[model samples]
Target: MISSPDDLLRLAPDAKSLEAGRRLFYSRRWRLVGGDGQWLWGEWVYGSGQRATESAVHLTAGHFVCNCRARERPCAHGLALVLMLKNDQERISVGQPPSWVRSVQYQADRQAKPKPLKDAEAADERQGERLALMGAGVEELELRLLDFARRGIADTLAQGPEPFLAAATHLADAKLPGPAGLLRRLARLGRDGTEADIARTLGDLYLFVRAWKNRRTLPPDRHAELLQFAGVNIRKEELLARPGLEDHWLVLGTAEGQEDRLRFRRTWLRGEKSRRFALVLDYAFGEMPFERSWPLAASFQGKAYYYPGSYPQRALLPSTTPGGRPYDGLVGYPSFVELRANYQKALAVNPWLYAYPVYLSAVTPTLASGQAGLADANGEVLPLHPEYDNFFSLLAISGGGTLAVFAEFDGYRLLPLSVVTEFGLVKG
Candidate 1:
């Protein structure tokens, strides 16, 4: 059986699945749940008497199978069954496997066994073809962007989104889906967007295109960034090969969103010892949950392997020490000037970085001239984004006094993520 909630969370594919499993466990709808030495069996009922669907999970051989229609392997029902067993061992009595459970165990054993590769050479050939297509797509995108520039920004906007949309579709077909999706988003920038906003968007695209074209001349780290932007993925094994830093990492905040059928989760962590910030990303498809989620406002001792880059922000937690505890005090810049200076250093390393983590010490939340902002001890104020509606909550927590705040800055405005309160860490 799994050790704890953290172990079970590690098994999940994304945050959504972990949350779903938690809900299922708390609902108290499971029955006939028992565990043998190797296998666990359970019946879960969803909805009312008539509309209810009975789902079963057969957990064995370090694997699980569920009868629920969810495409996610193991599914929420299976996770909940594990959680139930962990919470109350007496709830699941050991017994001989039932016929259905045995059948599933046999199938699971067979599926777990590795099969010989059918055509390794053919797989390599296919990969080569895909790379070639991507190269052609990049060239085409450069030409399209140049043409748009020559036609003038006003004329291109007047022509509507058809051209950009069509180009995005073509890029997707060529297997450059990341850039393609970005172009589609850019096409939606209508008259509502300010002229400066439009120019910045265009400038970013132009920079990316030029950087990709001259990638060979760029540094290794910058080249890696270009490759990532073009949809190339770096394997975990490759990242783990580098040296890892062992530190007590404080889990600060998280943001989750869905694009197409994939859920993207970004968790921010700050190393207590190293004073380095890291961004941990998790992606899941369909109803699958993320591998693991760091408990917010808690600190864990772990080894984090940083990806190769001049300003290494993305990292992978290959191994972690078991228990985590609440952090005592907030650590960061004492003033807005120091914060801006640090931001400039990070920006110099990677100009394309959109959002940067900022932690301000002893800043009073204020609303002056109908604008929300934070003023440091020195009276230096940094304006908060207008869309950040949680300032009232932050104000209440601060009680009109100076407070420590963690936020994301997009060069212009700050979006608060969490504030250190007298009671505890409060998320914005």
Candidate 2:
């Protein structure tokens, strides 16, 4: 069966493309729209009025092909074709796919085929090439960091953001997106951030560079972690082949963020018995098939195959079965002191873990000294993220009592995400 227009719209590269697809879906720009049992297709009279764009989507395999000059995949022509098949199917004639439609399937099958030994060797070679590329990028970055140390941050940042941005672009070109992101963050930090914040960012970048330089001496898991931080991808198949940690996992919370053109959501889960934390990160690019979600406060019995690392936080949950609510409501640090200690412990394990999830049971929302914060039973204050403006709603939920809170701890402050009260879960 074909997916709905909304589902198809989820993959659109941008709202502009989605709107364009919706318009194309109903417009009279298409002719001979048809489908067999397995494929939905159409011929769109696109910009070059003489050359008709052949748009086709596989009914079962979710493959889409369009013979058009559009740079993006599953372009508007294909999206509109699917919408037509779903919302206006009678307009589509029934027939087997022609040669052009079958070509997409052939490419998909070739790409999906397993060439274990050869692919592994090829991947290793690619990793080697990228690492070499990273070496050149890292050398220039080391010099930048050296300048910060010698010239002083005040003196260096006074020179402005150009140097930092150029270094970031070079790292990106080197295929080291992870470090590239850190460099960009530094450039954005500029002179606006506090002395502590700037120092911490520089420290993290320095340690990461050190980790990269000594990656070969690192243990297998640590080495893998380093590569990932440097923007190297470790395929799911590689992680799934590893033994998994079976547990009754509780959904701690979810957070969303956008990077460049892609939007991503991170679901934080913790094992009921194993006590291990797992992060499930999913990304969506308009018109791409990255539809993954995990319900909040739901319990799932599953085996999580973690990305190999010293901390082993992010993981791949290949499958899950409903396991009911966790033994009780959200359980977390008894006090702010304990939360800080635990975060420090985590930092000891992975110094680069800038943002870590911290849960607090029975914390009351408080506003004092012009700061929004959370207070544990003893009245110890943990400041809520400055950007968070949901305190009024949280206060309404609290009604002058304690509420369970889940927040991301970034060394100095807590960015409250969601609250669990007697009524239910409320995301901030």
Candidate 3:
């Protein structure tokens, strides 16, 4: 299996794709060996609950397939095996294949006249164990995300740095610190208490305070990074400290990336001519499969607040806890800009505007188009427009309405609204 972290990050995570594969799973016992990234190689029991001690080689990746008669892509047996691996169950011990399995392998080998990959038959229970652990970790992180959404941003920030502080404190206690440590701590939190409880209990006391308090004053880059560490992305900022729009915004789509153990969602406003705004959210606990919750696509309107930081509307964590514990790492979310003229003007002047017209990048400026435009920027550009990339495009469309435009850049890149200014819209 392509175990490279980057490859694993890029694996597709559509549940529909896995649905058929899930059916193939049944009551059979499976032993998982190492795989190429998304691919899982293993052996399992087959046949009508007879528990055919005969081991069989199975391969599962974006989809599941077994060289058995079950015909189903991901037979019931496959689903059970995956579920077991996902739930942190026991690991499959490494050893020689049973006599029945060896005989089957011999026949297949004779027919194919091919040499098996070195150690291909060697069972690796550890890999299965890891996968199961990672699956659980991912599910936990997704649950937390939904919880955060329910709590709303104000309520989360209102906690005032305790969680962030605790995260920092936990970082300090460990001596041999690195990315793994940071990820481990996040994974621990994913399974345990609420974000609030975790913040108050874990790590150094003073360090947490410093990070919590200093977050208010940290530079944009620093603040944004800290927030990312907590698996949150920075979307928009309110440099003027204005309150966000208070309304129901629809949750559009959510996507997962192999590059970062993160997920993003889109939300749009609802109403007549309800303008679409792309808001990007992220997760960073561990190697869990992507999250899928369609009901989240409902039209929800919430206030969008602007904070003074480079990350637009994000926060940051400290390097150490209040108790002097060294800090771990964090995650980052990128902001979407139309690169249009009107948006540039708003960004430059810093005036208090209630709600203005803003359009996504692909949306044409015509009456036929449903997209909205924010404002005009310098010279002759429309300024701010939405531009979503493949990773985030789904987030733009939720419950029939669109929220944001996923861009083709890292979360840190900002699209200049000046790039999308319509010459006709500008008084040249």
251-350: candidate 3 lDDT, tens digit per residue: 3233333334433432222221234343433443343222323233244334545344333422111111122222121111222343334445643332
Task: Show the lowest summed lDDT stretch of 10 residues, model 1.
Answer: 52-61
Q: Candidate 3: lDDT over CA atoms?
A: 0.35
lDDT of 2: 0.79
Q: By descending lDDT, how would the candidates be arranged?
A: 2, 1, 3
lDDT of 3 at 164: 37
In the range 1-428, model 2's lDDT, one tens digit per residue, is 43554565566667777677888988887887888877788888867678687888766666667656565666788888877766887898887777777787678777789788878889779877877888988887888789889999888788787877888888889888887787777777884566677788888889988887887798887787787788877777778899999999888788877767677788888888887789888887744435545777778998999888888788889789888654444468889888889888888877667679888888888899888888898998877765677888988888988988888898888888778766666685
lDDT of 1 by residue, 207-233 (tens): 877777788898999777777667777
TM match of model 1 to true structure: 0.74
Colliding pairs, model 2: 11-286, 11-287, 12-286, 12-287, 13-286
lDDT of 2 at 156: 72
The candidate 3 region of ten consecutive residues with least summed lDDT is 419-428
Once fitted onto the true fold, the runs of candidate 2 whose alpha carbons sit more than 4 angstroms away are: 1-38, 42-57, 60-90, 93-107, 286-290, 324-329
Q: For model 2, what is the alpha-carbon lDDT of residue 212?
A: 77
Report the Cα lDDT for residue 25, model 3: 40
State model 1's lDDT. Answer: 0.76
What lDDT does the true structure give each of the candidates? Answer: 0.76, 0.79, 0.35
TM-score, candidate number 3: 0.26
